[model samples]
Structures are given as C-alpha cells and as structure tokens.
Target chain A: MTTGVRRRMGVEERRQQLIGVALELFSRRSPDEVSIDEIASAAGISRPLVYHYFPGKLSLYEAALQRASDDLAARFVEPKEGPLGARLLRVMGRYFDFVDEHGPGFSALMRGGPAVGSSTTNALVDSVRQAAYVQILAHLDVTDPPARLDLVVRSWISLAESTALIWLDGRRIPREELQAQLVHDFAALAAVSAAYDEEMSALLRRILADEPADGPFADLVGQLIELAS
Target chain B: MTTGVRRRMGVEERRQQLIGVALELFSRRSPDEVSIDEIASAAGISRPLVYHYFPGKLSLYEAALQRASDDLAARFVEPKEGPLGARLLRVMGRYFDFVDEHGPGFSALMRGGPAVGSSTTNALVDSVRQAAYVQILAHLDVTDPPARLDLVVRSWISLAESTALIWLDGRRIPREELQAQLVHDFAALAAVSAAYDEEMSALLRRILADEPADGPFADLVGQLIELAS
Candidate 1:
C-alpha cells in the first residue's frame, strides 16, 4: 500500500490548489509577468495540469482576480454589535491588511490592467464595489436608501479605494491614522449628503446615535458646531 | 514681402505648435500607439522637423504631457474675491472644462501611461499636483499648514482626480451637480481634519465665514445643528 501510495486529489481540490499558487504569484507581480510554467512549478505540478484546470493563462488570471475580489469583499463584513465607528474601523483595518498583503494583486485588480481584457474581469471589479455598497448599506440598516444617499455611498467607496491606493503607493501616514482618516471621511461625507437629502439626514442621525461619545464622530460633530458658530 | 511669407516661425512658437498638435493626437490615442510620423503629418510639417524640436517620440510625449499638466494646474487658479464655496466652484468649473475638452488626454496624463518612462515626465506630473496644493494653501491663506491639514488637502486632491476620472468614464451625474458635490466633499474633509488638528479647525472657521448664507456650507451647518439638537 505504501509503495503504491498516490493520493488521489479531487478535481475541485486540484483546481483550487492551482488557483492558490497563481494568487501567490500574482500578489507579488503583474499578471503578464507570471506564467503557466511558473505556477505549475510553484504548485509542484506540471504545466499541462495547470492548463487542464484553466484553459490558458488569462483564465488562470481571471480566476485569481475573482478570488482576490471575493476575499476583499468578505473582509468588509464585521460584527454589528459594536459602536458604528469601531465597527467601521475594524472593517477598514481588514481592508488595509488585505492591501498590505496583496499589494500588486490589489492594484492590478482595481486598475483592470491590460492583461485583463475580458468583460468578466470588469464584472468582477464591479461586483467587488457592489458588495462593498451592500455591506455599507447593511451597516446603516438601510435596505432602501434614496438615490442621493446611494450616490454618496458609492462616491465614498471610490474615495476609499483611491485613498488606499495612494496610501499603499507611499506609506506617508501610519496605517492606523489612514484608517481613522477614512472613517472620518465617510462620516463627513454622509453628513454633507444629509444636508441636501432628508433621508440621508435621518440615516446619519441614526448612525451618529450609535457612535460612542468620545469617538471620532463626537469630535466631528463638535468641530462642525464650532465652525458653524 | 508677401512672396517671402514662408512665415519664419520662431523656435518656441514652432515647438508650441508641435506640442499642441501632439496633444490633440494623444487625446485620442495612447502614447505608445501614436507615432512621430503621424504627429508631423498632423502639424503639416516634415517628420524631421518634429525630431528637430524633440529628440524622439518619448521627448515629444514628455513635452506634451508637461504642457497638459501646466494647463491643468492653471485651471485650478480662481480669483480670491468671492465666497470660498463660490471660488472653489469656479475652480472646479475650469477643471471640468479641461477634462471635457481633453478627455482622452486628461485621462492619459493623470494615469501616466506606459509610454511615460522618463523621470522628466514624472516630475511634470508632480509639478501639477504641487501647484494645485500651493494654490489651495494660498486660497486658505496658510503659509505653512499643519501636517494633518496638509495631508487632508493632498487626499482631497486625489479624491478630486478619482472623481473626475469616474465622471468621465460615465456621465453618472450632471456636470454642475458633480462639481458641487466635489466642492462640498472638500469642505467636509476640511471639517473632518479640523477634528484632529487645531490649525485646520481655525482654517475651517476662516473659510466658512466667507461662505454665503444660502450656500451649501450654510445648509451643512444647518443640518449639523438640527442633528445635534
């Protein structure tokens, strides 16, 4: 039995192993710089095996990008039991961590680099954004937000992405500081949007009530009052 | 004299004309795809003439990118006579106008495409950002802003660039509405920064005082007060 031992891995398990190897390679370099032979070697398998799992290198890249996007989207979900600010900070922490770990891959996925030329890649990127939007709405306890509020949320998502990209490009600020700034930015945007829309205003009021008194939310409110006065 | 009207153009004028023609072509295609022969033909001049002005295609691209950056930096300068909100609105108007007229060029310049490999091109892009930063500081009348305030301004500039890129990608909102939202977002970011820095708080106070009574600033203040009460 020992002499004949060749563990039979299931098809799905083998496919996943190949994708895992590809993701590791992509996280360090651009898709174009990675090759099927390298991925196969990394997985201790043959190039033909990789091709069996994925038709070509582009298929492997798409699979890896999809997995990365899914992982990123999953990180946005945090427990709802804490103060809104704390919950948001936790979400951002996870986000920054992902960016730190998957720098090249995160940037490639966000940019939709020239290597990715399929509609499926675009859809994958959009799905990541949509997933974030849904989670934010869920955190706000808003199932049916108004169009203006929806726009504000979507804009904040873009801002967060841009901020992360810049932050990663240059570690100008401490990671914790960047997270706090982003959280504060989201609240401020929500407050500003509330100025023009009553629905957003109501949502802000609800969200603010859940914030701890000594948290960033209180500081923002205090600053707003001082500025206005 | 009429027969001698071969129009002896000066070196500077000829250079500017070549750059202008190149900008128009670059606005429609990537730098890698645009050729020196095409640029010369567009300018109604011989290819050697373009080479005489710029050493090569990369040199021409760098010159054109520098010109676009300078043009963009100039658009951010609005007279400091009106309300802060109004002044910002005017600045954004000019910016949107530039983006409108130079759609592909604006996107290409901001992205710093693959063709822009020279350090000079990087410096040109940085100069544009630095000019905007200086103009913003001057508008706030701050000779030396706090580190936090400085970071806020830099981050807002990134936000503005990303927002404009997305706006160009899709006309999701009316141009005027998008401008107003960006201006509002800037103010909101300043307010959020004020929560962490006293200098920013003071600057926010000074800027808010210049906002008109029925403007977005007033509405934001009114909403804050209503929410707090």
Candidate 2:
C-alpha cells in the first residue's frame, strides 16, 4: 500500500510521522492488535521501509510509548498564576484530555504487566509520575517539602494517576466533573495533612490565600460548611 | 538444605503449608529472587515435593497470591454498628497491617508488569479490588450506587491503593497517620461528590449523622472550616 500523493520528507520527519501513526492506531485498540504491516500501510510506506527505521514491532511500540510518555509529562506544566485550585483544575483538564485521547495507551502506561513488561516502559511510567510530582512541588513553590507535606503531595499525585486509570474504563463520569473532583481531591488530601502537621497547615494557608471564591478549593469549603450545618 | 522439625501432615495441609512458606519468602524478596529449592528447604521438604503440589514456580507463586488475596479481602470486613468514619479507619489500619507484613508481594500484586505477567495474577488482583469495593458498599448500606457515587467510591479505592504502594517505598511517613489520612480521603472524595449529587448529599447526611465528634469525618469537616475561617 502506497500513497499516490507521496511527497519528499526528511528522515526525522518521517520517523515522527510513523510514531504518531502508531500511537493513533494503538489508541484506537490494543497495541498487540496492531501489526507492523498495518503501521507501514498506515504510513503509506512499504513493510521493509518501516523496518528500516525500527527493527521490529516491540521497538516501535517502545518508541511510540516514549513519545507518549513525554507528551503526558508535558500535560502537567502550567504557568504559575491564579488560585492553586484553578491551576490544578486546568492541569486536570489537559490531563484528562490526554487520557481521553490515548485511552488504551494510557492504561498500558499505568498498568504495565507482561503485555507491556519492558523495564523501559515501566521506567517511562515512573518518569511521568516523577515529572508530575516535581511539577506539583514547583506549583507549591517549595524547595524542600516537610515530611507530611511530602506525603500530601506524593499521595495527591498518585491519587490523580489512579483516578485517571479508573476513569478510562468506559469513562462513565463526565470528564469536566472528574477534572474538578480531582482538584478537590488534592485539596482534601492536603487539608487532612494540614490538620495533622503544622508545616502543612502553614503551606495550606498560603495556598488558600490565592484561591478564588469560585475555585474548586473554595467550592469544597462551601460544601463542607453546608454539610456541617 | 532441609527444614528441621518436619511433621507428617495430610496432602491438603501440606499444600497449604507450602503456599504459606512460599508467601513468607516472597514477601521478604521479589519472587524472581526466590527459588523453588529455597521454598522446599524452608518447608523442610524435598524440591520434588514442591513440584508434587505445584507444577512449577509460577503455579506456586499464584497459589501464594491466592492465599494472600483472601487474607487481604478479610481485612476489609468490619461489623456494621459504629460511625462509618471509625469503621473505615479500622479498615485502613487492618489494610496497612497487611501491607506492612507483605511488602514485596503486595508490590508484585499491584504493579504486575512482565515479572508477574500471568493472566491469573491480574485476575486475582481484580477480584481483590472488587471484594474491597463490594465490602465498602455493604458498609454504606447501598446495593446500587449512583454514577457519581460509583466514581467517588472507586476513586477512593484507587487512592487507597496508590497511597499504600507509595508508602511501601521506605515507608518514611508514620503508618498510623497514613491510615487516618486515608479515611479522611474517602470522606473528602465522597463530600465532593455529595456537593454535586442529591443522592450523594443524602447519603453523606446519613453517614455524618452517625459520625461522632472525634471521628475522621468530623475531623475533616473541622479542618475545612478552620481553613475557610
């Protein structure tokens, strides 16, 4: 299978295009269900030409996974402004957008197992988690988080990751609500920590000072007040 | 290498003993790091005897996992009497007790990957999650949960899972604190859902009415109010 409108392209450009194509195919279905031939055909290139870039299917899968891992890490990056609650909500919006687009791939990244058992894949997953953790700490403007603060941030990061993994199954809940609930989830985890630790209490006070009335943090406070009353 | 003080036992009892021995060894170290010979020596039996019960290492590993899985599900079983907050805190305590006892095996159970790629192992993990979910719903007295309630419960389950996984790495934070924080987490996730859903709001009202002044739920509400003020 070849494209009639094929035009000259650089090797790196062609490699990038192939990775994109493989990710698209993998996202629609399991990576195992997608063959190297299908990838070559999808790329409008010959099978041998596909092998010329990557040795085999597994290599190509890992390469595409690497690309996806980077994109996912990039999703957590946000300009530091506004309420921490709003910033996190926006991050979740983009985070779910990634999960929504790459459903199966995202599952594979989080759940590893024998099907995608390469240490390389597991390492990629770890890197994404580490990146998210670092991004959250950067958001908190803390060079060194205290013991309990460390627990709160790490727990929140893991919560967000697992929340996305579970949401990927049928995606029954509205994405917008999950995105907002996750922001609230972070607040809840930190709030509990603040109650137990003075260091976390101070950090939380600083965080809430910037949070607006309409932000998820304030919304959680309002709901708690109503429940208490 | 022989296990001293061996006593004659029935076939079924011997099989259970081997499974227990295998689990104990697997807990201290990765399963791959363990050997069939070591298992037999620990059981004070011959290497071929382990084979008599299980066909191979993978089978023995799975049997150990099955036993561990049942023990974990049992950890969630609590009598239906007290406030849900106290009940959940007890559950977290028992859950962490299991985690502290079965460190590496618990990691293998959660992380899966190629090291433990068998479908049976993955199913065992799924069944444990289902068991935990069902047990939590029973505690709530809800046979059928609303969509958002489903998300809240499942998200809380996942949060508990990842929190435990992260805690196992060096376990720097105090276990008792993590346990209490997890109960607050469930309340937080549920409170967020209740804010938006009438069914959840009504359910939260029932749960909170039975909660005492000193329970985790009351503590969370008190913390949120403190932050707001």
TM-score of the A-chain for all models = 0.91, 0.92
lDDT of 2 at B2: 64
**DockQ-based class of model 1:** acceptable
Please tell me how candidate 2 rates in CAPRI terms: medium
Per residue, candidate 1 scores C-alpha lDDT tens digits across A81-198 of 8788888888989999999988887776554466543567767877888999999888888898766677777778887887777676666667887788788898888877677667
Best candidate per DockQ, number?
2
**Model 2, A25: alpha-carbon shift in Å?**
0.5
Candidate 1 per-residue lDDT over residues B90-196, each given as its tens digit: 89899899888888767765544565334576577668878989999998888977666777777788777867776776665577877887888898888877766
Model 1 has a DockQ score of 0.26
Q: What is the Cα-based lDDT of residue B34 in candidate 1?
A: 87
lDDT of 2 by residue, B123-213 (tens): 8887888999999999999998877777778778877888888789878788998999889888888887887778899999999998999
Off by more than 4 A, model 1: A3-11, A29-38, A46-52, A78-83, A111-113, A116-118, A141-144, A209-216, A226-229, B1-71, B79-86, B99-151, B162-177, B197-223
Least well predicted 10-residue stretch by lDDT in candidate 1 chain B? B109-118
> lDDT tens string, model 2, A192-228?
8888888888889998998888878888888889988
Best by lDDT: 2
Q: List DockQ for all candidates.
A: 0.26, 0.58
Q: After superposition, how far is residue A66 of candidate 2 from its true place, in Å?
A: 0.5
